[model samples]
Target: MVAPLSAWPWEHLGIFKYILYGPLAAKAWYSWMYEDNILKDLWCIHILLICTLRGLIHQLWSSYNNMFFLTRNRWIKQQGVDFKQIDDEWDWDNFIILQAMLASMASLIFPSLNTLPLWNLKGFIASLLLHVTISEPLYYWAHRFFHKPYLFNHYHSLHHSSPVPHPFTAGHATPLEHLVLCTVIGIPITGSILMGYGSTAMIYGHVLVFDFFRCLGHSNAEVVPHEVFNKLPLLRYFIYTPTYHSLHHTEMETNFCLFMPLFDALGSTLNTKSLELHKKITSNSGKNGRVPDFVFLAHVVDIMSAMHTPFALRSFASTPFCMRMFLLPFWPLTFIIMLVMWGWSKTFLFSFYNLRGRLHQTWVVPRFGFQYFLPFATKGINKHIEEAILRADRLGVKVISLAALNKNEALNGGGTLFVNKHPELKVRVVHGNTLTAAVILNEFSKDVKEVFLTGATSKLGRATALYLCRKRVRVLMLTSSTERFQKILKETPVDCQNYLVQVTKYQAAQNCKTWIVGKWITPWEQSWAPSGTHFHQFVVPPILPIRRDCTYGDLAAMRLPPDVEGLGSCEYTMERGVVHACHAGGVVHQLEGWSHHEVGAIDVDRIDLVWEAALKHGLKPVSSVNN
Candidate 1:
């Protein structure tokens, strides 16, 4: 019969006591015996207190004070730890620092046997040296192995999950991987002790040195002096400078050596060459490889894959059983007759006209003209067109009919080549024959807000403005020419003057209250009208400062309060940064090959002002719907 598990005294008296506990206890007892004879009562008491209470008490007190102060203080920002800073305070968020703290605690709690038959000061120092030499090489090789794709995905990917590395990301890896590294330090020290190093000094030296180096390597500050490191002969080989370890964090694959440079030199994985290559590649996108034709095609494939695929077409002869059973009685003959008529119409007349249109309409001059045409005919302009649609989406605008003028503004002439080529851009080619500016404006000006005018603006800009103002639609005119603005103003109605704003020319800023410019506002002295206020925000948010200037008259006329919210709930403030236009040629790539009346930039604020005026006059934002 077997004894009950809990009631078994023999199991409790396991081999652990004889094998592990007895050796450790006997070492401690022997050390205590030497202490009792060599030292008096007070000296023994001091040794006991220093070994047991000093380090633990200090760590505990500091932890409590830091926690208490951080929680209670509202204005005190989190001062993140830096490696270079000797007084760099550690927070619980620093996982590496926490691990080091734990190692320190373990070292303190388990006192080393000071004097033993096998132990000596020389042996203890050697054990400490061996621990660093052995443990660091092991870590370097293991880390390099983890960077291999398969191992990276399983073990090291977690460490790099944070795109912006913070103190918290350090030591954040799989538990199994973490345990493997932690165990390595212990193995080296234990082996040294077995090889006759004094256990007490070996254990204490290992913990203190390991923790110090570990914390220093993980520090954020540039504490390791560059001048000193460059001057140091072979010291850099033994000590991991701050920059050496930082390069590891920045570029993961190559800089695997930690605390020693031997592994890096041996494996030829040192990253100085890789970093220089990275800089060159980033500076010039084409430096690494040629921009392949398939790159854009790959993007298109990604977009298509994200969307659901349509089912394959069914064969003509294989009608489903349900279709045959349900429709055979009366609808079969009816369906066949209708299908034949549709096919006949499509084949004879409709297809002929479609082919004719394709031949005449599908060739147009490129948007930037012939000399500097966008290289990739399909994708270069296409991507910008999609981005334009996205820009419209952000401002709650809708795109409707796009009209392009024929060659020499002739009626019943060939369709505009530009509109015909990219039919997917949604433009309607119009023959601008005998139709007056008023007539064209009266027809399409009802619902359109923005007009992207490409060709010579004979009556296009003025007509669009008149029509939109009559219907209370905001107008944004895009033009490369300034003369077009003068011609439009001459023909525009007196009432329409308030509706149209020219963004390009210098004088237009004085005439139009709401002025826009393609160039950076601050570059030209005249561009800053003493009237309008400037509003600026970061190209990227949060940390970057924003700057803009406005005239007192402009602010007063615009009726904005002195203090207003600029961006993301921040106070409307200005900094001393220059406002430059992003002068990329593909600025409005997506809207190319479209007419002026079809596109415009809408300042939603100006639209709101227009809506307010309409409201004051007791009319809704949409006039036709309200009526």
Candidate 2:
């Protein structure tokens, strides 16, 4: 049996966790719907609003801190928050629920708490005074109490687990520790009520201010301007910076004050370097960050996929991509955000990791997948892609890879448009299709003598066909254009020419058990495939599993080497630490220190060479998906 102090009972609630707050929400709704005195019963509504605002504040901080390009140099902690930290802080909102429940019960026990004036100057003064004199000192000593060897081992260690804190990390604590915190928060609040000075505005203001400070302290980004302390030197003891709070987590024994360093000073436990480090970090904030050696230029697929961004929802991005009902409520908000980004945003650094001591970052073009099909959006999309390329080149990036539709041949001629426009550019522009082809071709077993191919005329298609023909495997090239098909057939040696045959319709592939799809196939088109056929796809927004009897493969992807470091988010629809082959291709280029631009048509001869280079550098192909 688990010890009583080891875990919280409600910790296993998972998605049903929201049910705890349903009573308060339902009360607010019922009062608005049926009660004549809705205003009199609004204390519950106020509580709900405050809870929502607290959640909003935490989310905003999480989003802003993850925008590394803006806060890279200003972050207090240099290390990134990995998947473990993300998981640990996932339930940070638990404290909010407990606090709400306690406040509701208090209102019932004390009739005066049910209805109150909106504002009172005396109440505000009372709250401020009680917070400074009672809450602060009580919290300081209570915090130190939990730090005792026995208490910390069983309780306080949970909060300390996230050494590189995010906004949510502020509320990550054991239930026992939170009870002490509830007391610490409730003392000031309850004291004001006893003195008849409690008012709605005072309550809201106190909690909002409390939440603001807590989120700021754990945001990891150094946002407090150093000039404030410089202008008022004595104020250093009154306020705590993110850097100050960070020291508490790292050093453990010092900087125990809550929001103010005054208590820490009184206790003689303040970190000595807090002020100095805050000043140094703030002084040079936004001036510089580590330059990436490689960049993977990608774009959003759709509104749903947009929320899967690392900065959008940390919990969502930490796992494999799947549409969940929870994301439905966010659609309207995400739609508005999409409109804003369409006109305002540019290529942005999404996430980064290190491999063999070299830095690699994923930069998004801010355009959605559907928008790529819009004729009018073509120029704008290309403009963003070009800007990212030039920016990488200016930053001395060694290799910039284009992912998915970002390298559409018609829009930028497989990245040749940028390469030719900037002839003097030193950064290598890579479409990475060579490795994409190799990944697809290698999926087949040697016994498979023939395979049906769709999108037979596309860049990846042509390379796959020629490579397979070279292996003497008969390839049923599906296409309407005899001219394009003959051109690819001509590229193969005369003896192997017969292996590459042109067929105009999907019906031709009915007999083939191995189908390589380079183009999207509708359910009707997919019906042509015989049962038990395995579909290997390089298609974007991979085809649906319309035929249940047939196995389907996810888009071609490769797993990062075991030694890869600091990877915290998944690539779109790809599993964590696994990326599209094009992405891995550029990684290999950077590791090999190659100088040529991998643009336009792929070199069939280089497919094997690139594949070998990727394995040599420890990048392994993700095992084929069968579903």
Candidate 3:
């Protein structure tokens, strides 16, 4: 029963579907726009806006989340999860050829059949089937050629590396191979459309089906229902089965069918050997199917604790050989913490590892009874800290404990080097070998104003205050415990003036929220906390350099302070809590867009965080900045 090409059923069905739905969608769009009362229109717009905004926010959030997971070493193939048997995967290049052929065909047919005055429904469907048939044989032969020695390594071998199919590995292919495969898909449909028989709907459906089938074959999920296949026995002759595709991924050669199962049988490639190979690969699935949350959490905790410690702060001073071992675990954890912290703070938080002073395996041995005492001492120290914070807050004084800042100063003939680079800016470098009450007072009391301290320490906090009596700055120390504060302050430094104020660590933790409260600071305003007092800000400036096309307006969006009037000095060094050094005159006056002058070759060294010593005491980036 040869039907006329002018009246194919599927083509008529498609036209009907478009005709039926198109007006309904159009009417809905217009009714919301013009026929609406103000309230109705506003409500509809609000709903659409909320949906769109939520999607955008979610997309950004996922990017950060993925980064954190990647950094935390969490993405490593866990023992129980992420099973890859290196045998059951198909080369993605095969799929690329398949998609290219389909895409190419789509490109051709849509323009020709839809536009021509002599367009017929039957011609559109025939053209589509012809595209499908032609691409299959074409891909089969091209795929076989990829196995040849001269071509395989540079061209086809990359896809064969992944023996197991995973969603993430779907698009992995050589660029040249992808182009060749895609061209086959594109040419026929384009040729069809040029012959004045274009149909956009048919092309879209063709691409959609091809992509859907490709994804289905590689998904590694057991989703296809057997009942559907059973009811239609004839389907077995045409559609490629999961088992069929799985076998292709396992074998180095054969099974070149693209859309249909008929080619493998006709080409004499389908056999018991390929089936056995795929089955053998699939048999390696051991019991575990899911990754435990606690494992991930434990790794994260280990990394965060290691990074937050003073040892990681001194990586640069450590030997490269030793530093790598110390830093390996921390890198992933630090990455995850940065991601989590970025979301929590809505600000950038960069984590650097200190490889110097990292504990070696030998340190764990029971030498000088130190290894046995280490945990006891750490627990005892933490307990004492907890007591100090609790005691002080109960009475009324603030307590702050300062730790040693020296990256490397040998203890017991072994010195810990500073592994990470120390910031060149105004970092308060303490000279004391060990932090004690007397050491802190001697070093910082002369200029000390408002002290923002965390943790619990009565001896250190009170002694420093007594020493700072000459300088009248408010003391605001925060800790989780209050009882510990009382015990420490009981032995207060003599002549300590301006009584120490007590605040909860809870309040301190939440301080960032209220810190920006009160009236917004105008350009004319002066510091409200105190003059000449050092404040610790948890803020980190943008680490990645901005695009040269970035202007003062972009800086403002990042919440950076504005430039001084004419000189264009961007004197604002971003900090977490406090605003400090700002750029002075001419700092911001770089040839305005000197960055865009070289479109492709960016001068990476030209970027600088411009801070002014005399003015706003903050820093901003300059395009062609001089350090």
TM-score of 3: 0.35
Q: Give the number of the best model, judged by lDDT.
A: 2
Candidate 2 overall lDDT versus native: 0.87
Write model 2 residue lDDT over 1-627, tens digit each, in one string: 554656756789996888988998898899999999887567788778888998988988899989876788896876678777888788889988888888888767876766777788898898889989999999999899889998888888989998687899988988777888888777777888789888888888888888889888898899989999989988988888889999999899999998789999989998899989999899888576677899999888889888997778888998988898989999999999999887786777788888878889888888888989999988988988998998898888889999989899989999999999999998999988888888888888989999999998999999999999999999999999999998887789999999999999999988999999999999999999999999999988789988999999878889898788778898877887799999999899889999899999999999999999988988888874322
Q: Which RMSD values do the candidates have, in order?
A: 27.3, 2.1, 20.8
lDDT of 1 at 564: 17
Candidate 3 lDDT over 1-627, as tens digits, reads 432221222222532432433333454477666785433223223223333343333323223322222222221221110113211222222333334334334424443332333335654675666666787777767777777885676656656665444332444456556655566555555555656555544444454455555554544332344444558866654766445665666675667676566677777776456334333333433322222110000011223232432123311211111224556765876767545643442211111111121100000010111221355444333333233323323423211111121111221110111112222211121211121222232233344455554332322333343334335655555544667666544544445433555566333423221121111222222122233323322112212222232111111111123321111111122222111111111112121211111111112122121122211333332211212
Model 3 worst lDDT run, 10 consecutive residues? 358-367
What TM-score, over all chains together, does every model reach? 0.31, 0.95, 0.35
19-122 per-residue lDDT for model 1 (tens digits): 32233344446656776663222223323333333334333322322221122121111131112111111121233322334444444554343343334676
RMSD of 2: 2.1
TM-score of model 2 (CA atoms): 0.95
Whole-model lDDT, candidate 3?
0.34
What range of 10 consecutive residues in model 1 has the weakest lDDT sum?
347-356
Candidate 3 stretches with Cα past 4 Å from truth are 1-124, 161-171, 187-198, 220-222, 226-237, 241-250, 271-452, 455-476, 479-627
As a whole number from 0 to 100, the lDDT of residue 33 in candidate 3 is 69
